[model samples]
Target: MIAKWIKFQILDTERQDWTRGYDTARRYFDREGSLDVPYEHIENAYPLGRWLSDQRRAFRAGTMSSTRADELEELGMVWDTADTAFAENLAAARAYYAQAGTLAAPRHATALDKPVGQWLTNLRRPNGLGKDPERTARRAEQLAAIDPDWNPGQLGWTVDWQRHYTGLTALLEAGGTLDGITPGVTYRGDDIGRWLARQARDWTRPNPEQQRRLGKVGVKPAARPQKTAARTNTKARAAKGSDAFTRGVTALAQYIQREKKTVVGRHHVEELPDGTSVRLGVFLSNQKSRRDRLTEQQLAALAELGYHWTQ
Candidate 1:
């Protein structure tokens, strides 16, 4: 009889603990509107996140009671966190597509306050969607519904090319004309004019599907500029001489000013006062290796910036 009484007391304590966890979870649900709490989250000094994780583990292990599971589900407890995360990211992607008209987001792009760019990039990797055939197909279908050309590589074009094309499409849809998109013109951070000029210069490069899409948007290949051979050669030499040197110096100066340091990563790009960008680190490295070829003016510029290869 004493042993029975002790067992009853232990069961009562377990019930109280479970009830307390449930109450805390309900409070969290009311505040956050979802039970998708971070695994390390705390609520009012309680380890609510760990408690929720424990509950999920218990449910999966078939140790949790049906009544308890039902109560938690009432508060929007999602057992499959992978599915929940995928759904949320899909919504964010859709939001991005609605605004950008394409899913070819840059690696640093964000949408709906989510890192949708990285998410899409990860999805593009092999087996990133999942190993399950059915699930992969479902996810692919959903993405395709948002933008048929979301995966540009599968369609024989680069993501950057698709990004620019989409930007052009967005411009056209907004009633922008082709003539107004000059070299300096930009849309959604894309240099529309420069890309159009390249497409015109190499009109035969893009596949038939790409050509059809361009045609559908009323974009025709433009005529190449006619230049005299002597003039072109002179300009080319000049472009390689003073202009390139000045641009590199300008970029290095800008980088030093902005970062308050001379150290630059190999991939760093510095924007110049003229709105153009230069790969300053690569330029500096190249100049340092070819210091023997630098003119007096170029050496003076580097000295002024406190950049000395000998040091």
Candidate 2:
């Protein structure tokens, strides 16, 4: 099921060209098994079909030359006959190319406008084939010297292969081995893996909010209670009030002109006997550190004092 899913994923992914699709499909089939899975289970079948149809439309739109159209047509025919096996499909495509009488034709031009033929010919050298290890080392050493922090795994292997192949010719033209051979450094897979692991850790490490969410999911950390700024400020204010309660109360009374009205709570305003209005909250007290209820006498006294008593 996983293999089938992966196959569908590969098929659905947008490749640069048919050649890239062929290469990727080959790799997938080699890693996974033959793609004989049910087509109905592939969610992107219609999308893939649409993409192929678009390619065919582009081919027929006179954008491609007659020769290019022929090549594309041959490729299409191979695909039509190909089974789910990517290697088999690639082989069939190659066979079609070989038989088309234009197998060696250049597909595109490079930055220098050099034909693909020239590029391919220049870059088709076998890996690890040089006489001197020091000479072979020069290319790798140069790459490392230029980028000390380059991850070998993540670095474009395709570009590196081209460089390694083409650089040999360049190195030879510049006067051979003794020109300047830096010692070759072979980076361990483990070191690159560790660097990748560190990168993954750095990228995915949670901020405080994410950590809290993770904690809710049963991931334990230091178990310290998160102290918010508002909570801290409130506690500090409460502590300050408790420490200087009498002075604070006195100051408040002074601020209100010292004419105490009928006592209620901290937020209630009432009229005083001196014709100056004062809040009834000035003499309010907390009973048992909980809400205090007003007695009938107290209520009557407040009402008689022209204070609006809200139930």
Instruction: Judge candidate 1 at residue 270 and give its lDDT.
Output: 85
Candidate 1 lDDT tens digits, 211-306: 888888877876766766779888679668778888898888878878767788999888877788998889989989987555434654674565
Clashing pairs for predicted structure model 2, backbone only: 264-280, 265-281
Clashes of 1: 0
Q: Give the TM-score of candidate 2.
A: 0.14
Off by over 4 Å in 2: 1-15, 22-47, 66-68, 76-311
Give Cα distance to truth, residue 248, candidate 1, Å: 34
1-311: candidate 2 lDDT, tens digit per residue: 99888766774554345555334334434554532222112222332323343444555565545774564444432232212222222232233234322212222422222343333222223222134566445434433343332221222122222223233333444565421323341121112223222222333333444344334433333334576777988878766645443343333345444544333458765443446554435443332132123322233222223232211
